[model samples]
Target: MTTFTVPPVLEARAPAEARGVARDGVRLMVSRGTAVSHHRFTDLPGLLDPGDLLVVNNSATLPAAIETIDGVRVHVSTEQPDGTWLVEPRDFDAARPGLRLRVPSGSLTLLRPFTSRLWVAAADVPGGRVEYLTRHGRPIRYSYTDRDWPISTYQNAYATVPGSAEMPSAGRPLTGAVLSALAGRGVLVAPLTLHTGVASAEVDEPPYPEWFRVPSSTASLIGHVRRSGGRVIAVGTTVVRALETGTPEGWTDVVIGPDHPIRYVDGLLTGLHEPRASHLKMLTAVAGEEALRASYESALRERYLWHEFGDVHLLLR
Candidate 1:
């Protein structure tokens, strides 16, 4: 796996707005092959050709982090077909089967381990999970973040479907103005839904399955773009997964890496991933290992920020 040590100071502690930068003013690192260039995110529309298509994720961020009455932090990942929720209890050392944590309108009972870190638990949340979360949950935060941020700070401006535990952050920097510019520049844009699970993958672990939908309209548009010799640029890793999977609606567990064949996507716009993150493997599959490594080195040397609220990277063919 391609890896590098990210300095602690490079971690973004807050949203760009809180750091005195406009949401669209965050730094953007563009890599075409092995050459790297720096620019603000607002410059995005001009970076691509007129016929290029930008595919974005419309899955919204959820206030998935809730504190139990006993003060245990639980991150709600996904709800299974059987109606049980997959969750992560942060620092709750005594976590075990039958342990129940009380929430505002619900109680979570640990049933078994879903993964090494996640638990498949039965949650009794009244009035639906979205309604319950809106009233009682906060956005998930890690040790790197300084404090809690509002749900708005964790959402893409165009998100309409509420399901993801964390933000599909690559699209976060595309403000209303940038969208307009892309349209004016004659760049086509489309949306797909991919409700992301908690981004708490253990080192070298593959991403867990999450619900996704590639609308027939979007899939047809992709075929149209490819036939016209236009590039299909996925706005985030979620979009890549959904577009490549070609599934109309269902759970996806596909993992793209260096050896994986790239069929639908020709470019990618995304955030800087942590060292050894499986996301990096998708980056490699899209941009090649040499380009991926050189881009990360440039990002680190230039001191660009990291994490969901930080700078963005554009990898193109």
Candidate 2:
């Protein structure tokens, strides 16, 4: 058995805040079948065919981390079918089914435990989810982050739906100029919605159910692209989850691994992820195990960055 490991030096600590280098100035690692190459993100427009379709996640990031009177930080994962929210209790209190946290902007009450660290709860905010989060919430941060960044810093260039707790970070480096460049080359871009949940789980833990929607138009486009010999390039893993097994609108618990063969996605444009992370399993499905191993080894040897705010990797088969 092989164990994947991400070294400590590769963890990206903060968003790109450098001058003279646009956020997209990060390096790009491209793997085509068994061949690997390196380039800058600005060169992405020249890498693919004009007929290729770039499927993007239009879901935006939300300010989901909040604190309470008792100082327990609540991380909102997503909304449930019952109109309540799924959240994680940062600092465990003696909270039970009826426990309520009186926040600065509103009140959040625990309904039950969804998981060991998560709770199903309701919010009685002054206005609504958006307004409440706007007034009191901050972007969810892991221990790797130095400080809280503004919600805008976590947003994608083409974000339209405000639902995801975290950013669909693969598209973060895509500015309007890059989009125009791709368009000028006859490449097409389409949108879908996948509201990503919390990432506080262990790396190999199977992902929880997440809401996704693939419109009829996008579905038809995918079919046409396949028939016309064009590739379907997913911008992020969230997009891969949505387009692969998603219906018009529903929840997805689909976990792509090396054992499962991919059907629709041809190339993947994504941020460098942690080693041994569940996402690597999906990458193995796209690139064979040996090829994936080679790409990561090359990335490590070349000192490419890692994490949501790090460099990008393009796996094209």
Candidate 3:
């Protein structure tokens, strides 16, 4: 009963990289346990107190999808403990081991299947993976995304470490200006690295184990702020997972839901998740079933948009 219907038109058609909207001009929906409110993304600084800390994911988005020699496009999802990668190949006719898939600048060999659509592959980038992908790859986009956008648009302003197959989109609205304003207001902002894997935004299954790192510095800051009675807000679910798991650095497949209570994070800043998506379960853990249902109803009634380039939701409980 907590999940509500979302209109198709509510889906985000494209990121600003493919179009001409101010990248950070999206709307924001703010919610407490009992009621919901609406505001522009610019008002984020005013919503918090001086001691509040906003944690964001610094994992940069990758131009992970590439067209191979045989007209098959592969989306590199995750880098495994070994040098090989987990990839999703589209329109691939012959999917078998030792198939040398060539990119514009390099090549890859499909080793075997990791999952249904995902394959384990060995990459051969002459100029290095990052450089080659920068030249030949495009950001992995879903069907709802009408056209291709530059990989730059998929990255957060604070992005540094290049790893994520997709964007940690919840932090997209936290523009440098917004961050600067928060700093001026004495609200602390911290960073964690949670390299997200490829997801279609509608995935119902639990997320795969993605690499994440919560450095000692970030952990210490979080502890200090919490001990001082300050609110610790995670800017995205990725950050929430990284913090709750509390690993110095490791892979996490932790799936949080209503049955699983989240600790450490006080509130959340996230994109409007679709109903039945696994992300909604994470939101349910934060806002509870009844409150989340009401929030969804309010969002649909107000015509708030969804997806990476659309509006955001601020959950304060």
Candidate number achieving the greatest TM-score relative to the actual structure: 1
Question: For model 3, what is the C-alpha lDDT against the true structure?
Answer: 0.85
* Residues forming the 10-long window of minimal summed lDDT in candidate 2: 199-208
TM-score of each: 0.98, 0.93, 0.93
**Predicted model with the maximum lDDT:** 1
Location of the lowest summed lDDT over 10 successive residues in candidate 1: 197-206
Candidate 2 lDDT, 1-317, residue by residue in tens = 15656677777777876424578887899998767899999899999898999999999998988898878888888888777888888868687999998888678899998877778898887876666776778999888777878889899899999988888899988889889999999899999999998874246567788999998899999999999999999999988888777577899988888888898999999987776578888888988888888888888888888888889999998
Q: Which residue pairs collide in model 3, if any?
A: none
Which ten residues in a row are the worst by lDDT in model 3? 15-24
Model 2 residue-pair collision total: 0
Please give the distance, in angstroms, between residue 232's alpha carbon in candidate 2 and its true position after superposition.
Answer: 0.3
Prediction RMSDs, each to the true structure: 1.1, 1.9, 2.0
Off by over 4 Å in 2: 93-96, 200-202
Instruction: Report lDDT per candidate.
Output: 0.91, 0.85, 0.85
Which is better, 1 or 3, measured by TM-score? 1
